[model samples]
Target: MQDILYNLMSTEFENPWKTIRSRPIYDNPWIAVREEDVLKPNGAPGIYGVVSFKNKAIGIVPVDSEGYTYLVGQFRYTLNEYSWEIPEGGGPMNEAPLETAKRELEEETGLHAATWSELGRIHTSNSVTDEEGFLFLATDLTPGPSNPEDTEQLIIKRVSLKDAVAMVMRGEITDSLSIAGLLKAFMIVSSY
Candidate 1:
């Protein structure tokens, strides 16, 4: 099965569309918007707008010995809504993802983990953005003081891993990275 899947993916499929030209539409420290002129798969000419992220998104699910995990609640300006999610932040392109996860966990929840394992990687909003994301499972936690950024007004919560999974099922946690990380963590813990 693995070989079949690998062969399928490794097979080079010719790109269906042809790019005519591209130009920058907007630019910022966090993201850049670009417009591309392309010939569609069906030979129609069209324009495509893509948002490129300057940093990789990192999420961490920090579990204590008691089977509990930490969550962070904050108001998302873009969504204009309050969101509950696992500790997450943008990792600079030059920095390691695990290091960013550790910083985010400590800054948002005041917890530091001695052990870390990668959970998964995802491409968030692949249709419109080039934002890549990574999730980590952190354990052996120790408490410390939180140092959130001035731009962040965050609330911290601790809940059982089971309850976190329930939140995901109930659609209470809509953040993609959080849902993915929590579900993976649940599976990892359940195997123990």
Candidate 2:
């Protein structure tokens, strides 16, 4: 059954969409937008707009020895609201995601981890943007003064890991990276 499924999957997977032409629609330091003329799967002509991220989105869930985790709260300009999320930021594509995660965790939350493990990678918004997010589990934390970016006005909160998961369930945390990281961390922590 495994071989059969693998054969079917390997054989059946092929890109049906074809790009006729793609033109740059917009570009900034963080993102680039492109408009593409394409042939749909049904062989019909269509237009697809795609946003390409210049960096990988990195998120860190810092779990301390006391079963507590830290959250960062800041006002999101794009959402025009306050958001509570895991320590997250964008890292240049040339850099390692783990290194970026470490830097982001310390910058936003003032916490450093002695050990790090990957939780998972997620596509932040696949439908419109090609922004990929990397999530990590940071353990054995040491607290220090945070050094947030000049544009950031952040609040740090330490909560039990269970409460952090509950916040995700209750929709208090809406950021995709935070939701993904927290849930993954919860599952891993529960197993130990």
Clashes of 2: 0
Kindly give the stretch of ten consecutive residues in candidate 1 with the minimal lDDT sum: 119-128
- Give the clashing pairs for model 2: none
Which residue runs does candidate 2 get wrong by more than 4 Å? 1-12
User: Per-residue lDDT of 1-192 in model 1, one digit per residue for the tens?
Assistant: 999999999999998989999999999999999999999999999999999999999999999999999999999999999999999999999999999999999999999899999998999889899999999999999999999999999999999999999999999999999999999999998899
Candidate 1 ranges with C-alpha deviation above 4 Å: 1-10
Q: Give lDDT: candidate 2, residue 185.
A: 97
Best by lDDT: 1
Query: With candidate 1 superimposed using the best TM-score fit, by how many Å does residue 81's alpha carbon deviate from the native?
Result: 0.9
Query: Among all windows of ten consecutive residues in candidate 2, which has the lowest summed lDDT?
Result: 5-14
Instruction: Compute the lDDT for candidate 2.
Output: 0.95
Instruction: Give Cα distance to truth, residue 151, candidate 1, Å.
Output: 1.0
lDDT of 2 by residue, 137-187 (tens): 999999888999999999999999999999999999999999999999999
